[model samples]
Target: MSNRVLMKGNEIIGEAAIRAGCKLFFGYPITPSTEIIEYLAKNLPKAGGTVLQAEDEIGAINMCYGAACTGTRVMTASSSPGISLKQEGISYCAAAELPVVLVNVNRTGPGLGGLGPTQSDYFQSTKGGGHGDYRLIVLAPSKAQELYDFTLEAFDLAEKYRNPVLILTDGFLGQMMEPVELKEKPTSPEVDKSWVVDGARGREKRIIASYSLTNEIGEANNLRWEAKFNGIKEKEQRWEEFYADDAEYLLVSYGTTGRISKSVVLNARKKGIKLGLIRPITLWPFPEKAFIPYKNKIKGIVTVELNTGQMIEDVKLAMDCCVPIYLYRRQGGMLPTETEILEFLEKQFKLSTEEV
Candidate 1:
């Protein structure tokens, strides 16, 4: 039976990972994301799991790499700057096709900006954050419930695709509390250890490095990685569409911004504004196909984000700029409030009516 409990987003994610059969977690304490590490440190061992707090983000991610190499479910959590330090390890995990789940509670950054929510890492995440030809299956959760649900789903997706999965969140979501229904715990799947070198018992030596110096070998490796990424795009583009029917304008957003946008859409509906939302759950393997059908029907899209305008670029690309794409954003620590969004929508309606 599912049980409901009020919890913070970071704690929910950590607990959900454990319920998803994740046996190992290694991470460094970072602002707005430290709750995840604290949760795991307190409860993982009681659940027959292991949790390690490394000296730094690099060490934490490498610890995850070692655990994942043994075909065990492993994870790490951090904010933007810490995530930056772990990029090299994330790339290696991707190249090695290891199933590791990473939670990035995004914060403003270029370097150690602050402990405030920011989606500035959109390009870094979707465009391959580290040096290599690979992609991470990135999931963006807007609510505490989604944080729980997506954390479990992330593990499944990571294992299914044999690639790293990233849960991209922001400080607002991490700090907020909400009721979440804990789902049934998943049973651990038997992993094939033929490729893993736990101790190299009676098998050829195993190498998991991404350094193939030969041009031919490197090209072949790239091709293989491309195939895997393509496969993911084909099978794993997840999104949520709300109040789309009879709507002339659509709002596109993710993470905490999406939650606020949902409220805006609801408020606009009361004023008879025809608007809807397309919330991308999987940021990577982006739901490009989802927007194709609505391209001609919708008047335009308003891209809402916490950063200045990162994901807006992706929305424009997905819609092919067929309709006018407007951006509504907040930066640093502040979130785009529902009142601000509704005001923006009212202005859009007036402007569009005048244009017509």
Candidate 2:
């Protein structure tokens, strides 16, 4: 027996947040991600939780910052444009070392692109969305099941690291519906609350600020944050490999695009193409080690992305561009179908064959 149900990706995120012990949610509605706010508004109160529809994305994130600093589990969600507006607040949360969860249901965009699914936010998310020497724990879930499971884990990771955690999904996964098992809500890891601002009733006054006027103090704070990031990089890299055991070519992708590329790998294998897929679950840590083993073994690597080639830069850094590395991309919310991806791979194969 299981508590399985069919749910849209965005709605599942809402439900998972509640089950993850999130007590407060503040967000401004945006395409593809609006369902999360709507679902939470309707359901969270039933479970003694609170949801607020803020005036704007900026307002919503500042609200999140306030709630999180009080030691309450809090989250906020938005799309690319809205996420841009929230960066300043996100930086504040990071500098203050507040544990918060931010969900971005990415849509195509440089500015006001359609509501179509896109992964163009990779740079914004993984490279520290705000201005600072900080990093976020980014989780990319391709399916509804991973959306639910990762949301459950995100809260704990945020608390454990005392940093903001981001659940990065795109319009495709945000709108699609699938059957998923709703597991029992896991308890968040217990952390010291002595630093929280709760009126300072019985202890010394506590302050949470992202400002360090003096150069010496600023350097010290940044050094400590860098140490934490190094620890996370070592321990939190996560990824999935399919058909890579004897693969001669590797395709790197993440989120919904990763699943599509997996299908391409399967079809290519049937035609004796020897293609493999490496789907990253954690984007910030970037799963650099995942490429190390295949570096010498593979003849070439191709990175297929929803954006022009955001993650490919990280791929190049990971593999040092050892073998021939190619980029196959479609932007502005266009998805790359299996046939198109296969054709691209075939073109590369033909070129290699000619060279040989």
Candidate 3:
């Protein structure tokens, strides 16, 4: 508690990684996320950790894959375009069942868009941007503190599930400075490393590969991966609710958008509007269970985002289309103001803005 300090979200992630026993960082510097590598480069060595700036995102992620096989915690950070470059390596890590932490501080992007903040990478982060039936445990952090806490949690989740875990943030959250409490060191517990390919000096050699030469082996691998994914889905769904117990209209968002929507919910309530919010912290598992309590209560749901519409699909599926869902988005790094969001809700729900 005495360790509280004002810090950028990206730097907080680097600090959290250091405390979590992550000794290796391999990444190329990219805006919105470069601070992560920079912070780690300066501080990680002090913690007896090593930081390497790879020639490219491809090299960086492959480095992560290699380190993960050694049964050690390693991480990489990049923004949208860099993250896209690392997808194949990410898929390889997933297929190899490696435990690695990845950070995507998203910026505007179709391809090299700009340094402006945006949630455009939501699809890529949550929908298996790489190839061939794989899932990354994606966690969305809405604030600077969450960026710190979730980084610690991501390392643990990646190792526990033996898969890649992604901390999906954006340029805004990554660069934003806020006061955050630095939680105590070493939040991770020891895990079994008998599966690692570390050493075979006195025992049988261990091989870690993703290749499947036969259809039978390929299908079996896919089936096993699917079972593991199902287990994650069943156990890891997490969310945060705001004034949602008996609301009629719901706002669903994550990351930066979730932060803004929190205020919109409060303002709407003050004006006597029945508004609530559900912020999904885990994007992969989708937190469908969070909608269960609101299913019979809410009239409609609106998904607010920095992109056109990606998370709305998950929201619709979560409710099974039993409730009317709408979208309010700002593209090309634009952020929707709380007033704009409230206006949209007022019009959509035909609710009064009169103060109670």
Ranking by lDDT: 3, 2, 1
User: Which residue pairs overlap in candidate 1's backbone?
Assistant: none
Candidate 1 segments whose C-alpha is farther than 4 A from its true place: 187-192, 349-356
Candidate 2 structure quality by residue, lDDT tens digits, 239-299: 9999998999999889998999999999887777889999999999999989989989998
**TM-score of every candidate relative to the true structure:** 0.95, 0.97, 0.98
Q: Evaluate model 2: give its TM-score.
A: 0.97
Q: Write the per-residue lDDT of candidate 3 for residues 6-54, one digit (tens) a residue.
A: 9988999999999888999999988989999999999999999999999
Query: What's the residue-level lDDT of 162 in candidate 3?
Result: 97
RMSD of 3: 1.2
By TM-score, the better pick of 2 and 3 is 3
